[model samples]
Target: METDYAIIGGGVVGLSVAWGLLRRGKSVTVLDGDDGSFRASRGNFGLVWVQSKGMNQPRYAEWSQQSAAIWAEFADELGDATGHPVPLEQKGGYDFHFSEETLQARIEDYETLKAKIGGNYPYEVLGHNALRKEEPHIGPKVVGAILHHQDGHANPLKLLTALAADVRRMGGQVIVGKIVIEVSKPDSFRITCADSTTYGANKVVLSAGLGASKLGPAMGFKAPIRPQRGQVLITEKLPKLINRPSLIARQVDEGGIQIGATNEEVGHDDRVTQPGLSGLAAEAISAYPALARAQLVRSWGALRILSPDGLPIYQESADMPGAYLVTCHSGITLAAAHARLLPDWLEGTGAAPDLEVFSETRFAVS
Candidate 1:
């Protein structure tokens, strides 16, 4: 099939970009891998978080804030299109700190970042008592929190399903079980899959999550991406115990407390371990004592696709001008920006956001 863009990877990142292209009246085709793929979209903490990001790079913080600002409108449109309400609560999110020293240190970092961003960073430090006033279930072990207004949580699975449905409704072809093995630009871009099915497009996007590491070099990208395993746990449905999400846990829209995410450098081994689950439970209980009574329902591990510097990469292949590489660790958080703003970058329009900092050249050796 011939299309304006052939997107490799049907995860949230790929689909969000495809959705944006289709909204611009472009013909698109999405080629996705089989069930064996290491899909982080399926197993994530689901936080549209902005705190503790871009601590070293202010531009990343600005980019995240832009995406978080548009998330509510984006979710509304997706819900309207697919009839699946992507439950999102963007009132704010907290970064709970058990020690006064750490909380104060983070505040200092935020102050520096705020100045760098021209005082646009919005956050407040709530002491233990003040935080308890908002979250009655907060335990005494929790000392304080920095609530960033742009942070929030959402039902990530629902968002993924809605995006897939809406992409199809917009007449975009989503081909599953097609593992793209080779991509070459011979006049028009040609993508050869394992099954010998060839697809042609004017432009190509390599957003295959962890799979990009293999395909990116051939397309003139130093994809420099790696897989870090994160294990998470979810409790059975119960009365709301968390009013806001933290790095430790959040009470999901369905009343289940989602406790997560131990960052382990286990290379692509996405297997939940006993120690990982135990550590998560201990931390959650320390944050909210009530979760100790909640029954555990599910535990899972997923790989997070990360660049060396832990920032999103947006670059067009130098050798092949029409091929683009888009990948990020926070796909859930950046879905809105990808769907609404990134199409301009891919099209090389004058309206493109200033994404020069995200290019792979930043990783070039001296």
Candidate 2:
């Protein structure tokens, strides 16, 4: 079948873009891989964060801020469309530091980034007493925290479900298990699938997450993307422990303490390592000594697609004028931008947000 835009991935990033395109009166199709595809949504920490982002590149921080600023409205629209209200909290999040020296150091870095980004970075350093007042369950080992006003968490499953349901309700096609094997554009783009199926579209978007590492180079994109494995631990539903999310942990809407995320450069191996889990548990217990007594319920690992610099790659193919590469490490944080703002850039409209900094040109070949 023919469409206006054929998206190569059906994950949150692709679905978010597809949802946006359909909202603008474009026909869209999402070609999703088989069940084994590494979906970042599965193990996301559900953080809609802004602090500590774009430490080197302020544009990224600006982009994230733009997305976070409009996220609640976006969620509301999706909820009204699909009747699945996404549970999100924007009451600010924390970056807990166990040592005073590290807390001061992080503040300095954030100060530099804040000045570079028009001095709009809103965050406050909370001393131990101030933090305890905010989170009564905080442990003694926790020294302080940086409470960035833009950071928060959400129920990722609900967000993904709402996005997919609303996309279909808007006449967008979400085709699962259609592994694209080849893509070539003679007149319109022709996509060959492993299931011996084919699809055609006027434009193509390579937002297939880790799958882009293989398909991007063929489409004239330097998709220098790699997988970083992150393991997460979930505790039994309990009384409120974490008042806000941090890189370390958060109390999920369902009352479970979600502790996570070891950044391991272990290639494509997404298996949970005992040592990784142990380290995470130790740090989490230190952050909230109460967590040491909570019973563990579930644990998992997911892969994060990262460019060399960890910024997003938003590049239109030079050879194929209508083909685009869209990838990022912070998919949940940027979902609003992908859905609400990015379509303007794709359409080359007057309202397109400037995304020149995220181009592949930033990566020089060795």
Candidate 3:
């Protein structure tokens, strides 16, 4: 029973791609690991953000912009299919700055990136007074914010759920708890799981997130991926305090103020620490003083799948031409592009996106 495509990870990245391929009438099978696997999809900050991204690479920025452009329609379609609304708020989002120096520096970098994109970057710098007008609860400690018009957030859990349901609804097979242990190309691609179950497909997509580091080399991928821990915290449902989502926090549709994400290089340990949660709490409080009184509801830590350059890696195996590797840190941000546009590239339709810059060849020794 060979399928058209066998996806090796059922996380956001893999499910998004599977959803796209299924829409094109392709036969697909999603092989997911057990509950014990470290899953970033379920533990993300839920931001469909674009600001502060691709500072060093404008192409990546443009790609993110492209995804943001089509996100609304994508969400709508997923909702319609799954009957589960993927709550999305794209009114705008912010990058709050506590000091003038960091704000100025980031604006300078954005200016350079904006120029590279022929001025496609749409952002506005708001002073304390102006920001206060937008966010009345904003604390005095926060100096300003950069509101990027294309930035926003969504219910990441809902997005994942809708995608999974839609994939199955569209006749795609989803096999859970199938931790793939080996991938070999004898004739067609054979993906062997730990339970001795085997599946065959015409092509393979390795989107196993952090697990790619282990499976990539066997399939001719550099797979130079590492894990970076990000600790996050959430507050009890409260009145609307945040008008827009930011790296610091956002008021979720369900009423909780989702504060997050301290970037730490603490290896693969996704455990919340006192210092990490404390730092996040202090920062959130600094941005919104009202949060000091908000009841802390939950705290968690998740590992971000990061490439060496922190950009997405989209490459085909040199030894096994039909095998492809697709992984990125911005799975939520790029979900639209993955589901709406990436299938063309995977099918080699000639209308495929020019993703050569993201190829593994970039990491080759000079």
> lDDT of all predictions, in order shown?
0.94, 0.93, 0.94
What candidate 2 gets wrong by more than 4 Å, as runs, is none
lDDT string, candidate 2, 178-296, tens digits: 88889999999999999899999999999999999889988999999999999999999998777889999999999999999999899989999899999999999988888889999
Provide TM-scores for the models.
Answer: 0.99, 0.99, 0.99
For all predictions, the C-alpha RMSD in Å is 0.7, 0.8, 0.7
Candidate 1 per-residue lDDT over residues 1-366, each given as its tens digit? 589999999999999999999999999999999999999999999999888899888899988999999999999999998899999999899999999999999999999999999999889999999999999999999899999888999999999999999999999999999999999998999999999999999999999999999999999999999999999999999877788898899889999888988999999899999999999999999999988888999999999999999999999999999999999999999999999999999987999999989999999999
- Sort by lDDT, best first: 3, 1, 2
Candidate 1: stretches off by over 4 Å: none
Worst ten-residue run, lDDT, model 2?
A: 34-43
**Which 10 consecutive positions of candidate 3 have the poorest summed lDDT?**
350-359
lDDT of 3 by residue, 158-201 (tens): 99999999999999999999999999999999999999999999
